[model samples]
Target: MSKNLEHQFSMLVREVRKEFVGNGPKEISTRFVGNWAISEMKGNLTNVEKFMISSEQGKQMVHEARTKMVKQIYKKAEVVNKFEALMGAKVLRMFSDINIDEDIAMTVFVFEQSIESKGK
Candidate 1:
């Protein structure tokens, strides 16, 4: 995909995260590979979350909550529709994971067709 399209996708990801999670990552980079749009996000932890991760139990709880919350957010019809519209393809699946220690996250969207080709 072109750099412009990738940038748009990155912004869309950031916006979705901010809208649902109440805070967007400080930085995001997105790339198209095969039928997937993969995004790497940095600085996703809020001040409260940063403090919570200091305890082992708090760290586990935060990780579990964040992971489940992200999955549920992506499963929403509105979220799925927005991504499908942006990529011009049906969404097949979505995957997300976060590392509390590093305050980093990765979100991957799988489309029914190659999004790279659609961008051309």
Candidate 2:
């Protein structure tokens, strides 16, 4: 990106970081690889897909993925921090610090609504 864009993105990321930090760590659920599959698994995938592609069951996937993810997260602080910063910004922009999950869901709903409304 251009210097100006990078600066703006950095500022936005900083704002997000502040909100996220202010809310604290335990309350704010961040993904450390394991968290991703833990929070995102559908529990309804086909056996074929799970076995052939994933090479393991959902639980095993969570364990292995989490281990790998945690390692990557620890090794690459800069990239992880940037991702966290973006996530924080997005969460902050969409919801109050008090009710993060609900706010995030509502934000998505609202964005979808806006897109649909615009399409109409």
What is the TM-score of each predicted model, taking all chains together? Answer: 0.96, 0.22
TM-score of 2: 0.22
| Candidate 2 lDDT by residue in tens digits, 1-120 | 333333343344334434432321222221222112011111222243235334435445544443343343334456445534533321111221112112221101011111211111
Specify the highest-lDDT model's number. Answer: 1
Residue 3 lDDT in candidate 2: 37
The C-alpha lDDT values of all candidates are 0.91, 0.29
- Consecutive 10-residue window with the lowest summed lDDT within model 2: 105-114
In model 2, which residue pairs have backbone atoms overlapping below 3 Å? 34-66
Model 1 TM-score on a 0 to 1 scale = 0.96
Q: Tens-digit lDDT track for model 1 on 1-120?
A: 477888989998889899999999999999898899999999999899999999999999999999999999999999889888887889999999999999999999999988876566
